[model samples]
Target: MTPSLHPTPATHLPLTINDSIVLQSMLGVGAYGSVYKATDSHTGQTYAVKCLSKTGLDSRQRAFQTHESTLHSLVSGHPNVATLHKIVEEDDCLYMVLDCGVEGDLFYTITERGGFVGNDVAIKSIFGQIASAVLHCHSKGVFHRDLKPENIIMFGQSVKLVDFGLATTEQVSSDFGCGSTFYLSPECQGGYVEMVKSYDSAANDVWSLGVILINLVFGRNPWKQACPRDETFSAYILNNDFLQTILPMSTELNEIIKSVFCLNPRKRIPLSDLAKRVQACKQFTTPEFSASFASSSNASAATATIGQSGVAGGTCFVSSAQREDKDQGDSGVDVRSRA
Candidate 1:
């Protein structure tokens, strides 16, 4: 558990960006700052604006904010990752203008769709894009420590990775504070404040990706945490044969799963390697799965709404309910676990 974050004062509430856009309604509040729905007075375009009060943040928190903003500037041009339009600093606060994910996030879509079962095309398309996005980030020397469903936003027909507050450089020490518990890799579990062990951040991303893929397919995480102590994980590690029972789909996909979920970080497949394997999969190459976005009405309402709720630009992914679970823009560390 982490220490509680100090509160941002109300005096900093209403902020204007670039002297053009004015922040309007409160979208949501997370560990880092409060998100607001802002309107561009000139363009009349709406964007999800994140405002961080510098007054209350400690040195570590300030460093995290700087790191996130820097990473965003470096990794903004990718198709699958969210674009950071501009960043502004004024009145002891930081303002970030970003491309809004009008269709909300994947978590809500998953809840509405019931599950990703029988919708292999959507599953493959989403996963493929995510792989490409993560790969692109890695190529740019950025590693997203927290890659979960909530961090993924549906941008028009594509999905973009958001919230780089926990992002780190490609070269990272094994011990770092990042990732949510359910998504943490085996090496990321034990080390917290006192004990700092070394682990691969890239491998950590892949492990989280595997967990997300499983959730999309099966509707729940296979194990609470990816350690030997977890009963389901222990059984699966004892016998890789469980792959047949859990994900009894294409052998190629299954093979990819095994490679990413390897207990040893050294053995885990690199993002580039996994991307190649994913591209080679025949099951995913079928016409239905080849498209980058899911087709509507082919599956359940829960699945259909993922791409249907909104289009490329509109008020998307703004909810207090979801914001409560976020880790204030850092690696999801809070005074106590949200769960």
Candidate 2:
């Protein structure tokens, strides 16, 4: 995991923007800018405004910002995505007016609960919305290269996908190492070592979704990176059911993961089918996730991360639940525009 994923509290923001917009608080923080909770004084309406400063952006960065806005426009119509109402540009910065959510994100919620298991109803409702949003993007030829708990804001069980900075219109990209380590697909981690020509961006999105499923049930990543150097991933490569040892996974859930986590991207399950499988899944966790083994699960979540620190990026990914004391924002997921 990159150190940048840890969202820090923004200490200062303009008192107001343009003329009637009053910036209330920080929603999310990212590489190029930070999202703020703002209001329209004239209309007395609320919005989550994503602010991007032009001060430090170079030619490439400026182009990347434009590209992100374009792709986000293509898929923002979806019900599960955060709506980008309009773009307002000033001499100093760019502001994106978006849907306002008073409730916080899934990352903050999961981090607080230490992974809520045996609640298939809430999991299904949340993951189902996420699947619909991803499928909507793929249908429009836009790929959300970044998909994780951090990028999703929750309204109880419902979710909205955010942070299109890493999005792309390309069907394939040779731009290896574009996302965070834990959620990256094997083909995406193709740095100089693999010399990978290109990989299917759509398939790459599916792999990230698979990791997210593991996170929903287990409250931890299945492995750090999909690379062979990682011990847990290597064990899973040799024996498909290795994840069962770390977490109480059911056979049905295992089947779905196997299909999604297939080594061959071409052989990976289609998004439409995958969504149905997820909706049909009866149990993602065994009886162990109940009160009886709650303490045991917590102990194991800590140990698994220690034993299998991921190789890429030279950082270990601990569960968001165990990583911090409290989350500081109600909305915003900031993924760096690595691609």
Candidate 3:
């Protein structure tokens, strides 16, 4: 007979779940749940098990959890995307077994290394894999609304994208301001003179990817938010050379950013083409900027090389590079439908 799983109210964790699953120490906690580092009893395999408490989650929140589970299961096999092995449901909570990223996340990696300023090879490898994962998701009829560095996890040299709580199958959404502030497109941010009744979620994903590319190269965000209110983004809208003028980026890199962040959804570069161009680009920044970044001992000093890009102050950002996936719902909209 299979052993029953029982939880202690204090930790809300069970010693074992059925025949194979064994819960270990707690990894982190989200709005309604906690993630644990667990192991398979029989095979001795490690996993990241997320436990969502049914304590006070309403029907809608539970549906969102189902939505997250269903979408993640659908895209589990992709190498660059984190794998969802199985989900176990009990009377008190829900548990999802997923791949554990041991080394850390891309954000931590970049912050630890100071940045990827002169590392074209690592950029191509990491960014290319991320683009490939997005393409696979698009092919599967799912759109990953959130694609920031914080959502990406690393296992040694390999990386996998995670946190699909906000994903949707639909191409367009009326849910304005749905994603992270820094990574959102102008249309997604929604306060333009032209009334945007709805916006393309896919295009918005591409725009987020662009911001992540910049983060990998510069170790800082282009702007706190992508709306007219943010002076940095406002300047970019008025002047085509705004990004180039503020930072010492190469022509190839500048053009790519311009294309990726284009105001029109229809004009945004396709993921496939963007993937190719990323590898083809000769350099990401000028030698002077690269040298300065190399000389700077800390990330803050390295980011200061850009005259007014706003890197020193954490005042503008809602999330940091060190932020964990446990705070998933707090970072983005989790609009979900009943399963």
User: Across residues 6-124, which tens digit of lDDT does each residue of candidate 3 receive?
Assistant: 32332545568857788876655545556677779899988887777776788987888888889999998999988989999887778888888776667667766555656778888
Candidate 3 differs from the real structure by a C-alpha RMSD in angstroms, to one decimal, of 6.3
TM per candidate: 0.78, 0.83, 0.86
Question: Model 1, residue 316: what's the lDDT?
Answer: 25
User: For residues 271-319, what per-residue lDDT tens digits would candidate 2 score against the true structure?
Assistant: 8898999899877766555444445546345434433534443323345
Cα deviation of 243, candidate 1, in Å:
4.0
Q: How many residue pairs clash in each candidate?
A: 7, 1, 0
Report the alpha-carbon TM-score of model 3 versus the true structure: 0.86
What lDDT would each prediction earn against the true structure?
0.66, 0.72, 0.73
Candidates 1 and 2 compared by lDDT, better number: 2
* lDDT for each residue of candidate 1 in 1-339, tens digit (9 for 90 to 100): 122345343344455679987776565556666666677889998777767769877898787787888998899989988778899888588877877666766665665545455566677788889999999998888888888777787765578888887788955456554776567877776532234467788888988998787667544455655655566666668876554444333556777778988877889988788767766666622233324334444435333333342322221222224334444434432111111
Off by over 4 Å in 1: 1-15, 190-196, 284-339
The C-alpha local distance difference test score for the whole of candidate 2 amounts to 0.72
Q: Which ten residues in a row have the lowest lDDT in candidate 3?
A: 330-339
Candidate that would win on TM-score: 3
Top candidate, metric lDDT: 3
| Residue pairs in clash, model 3 | none
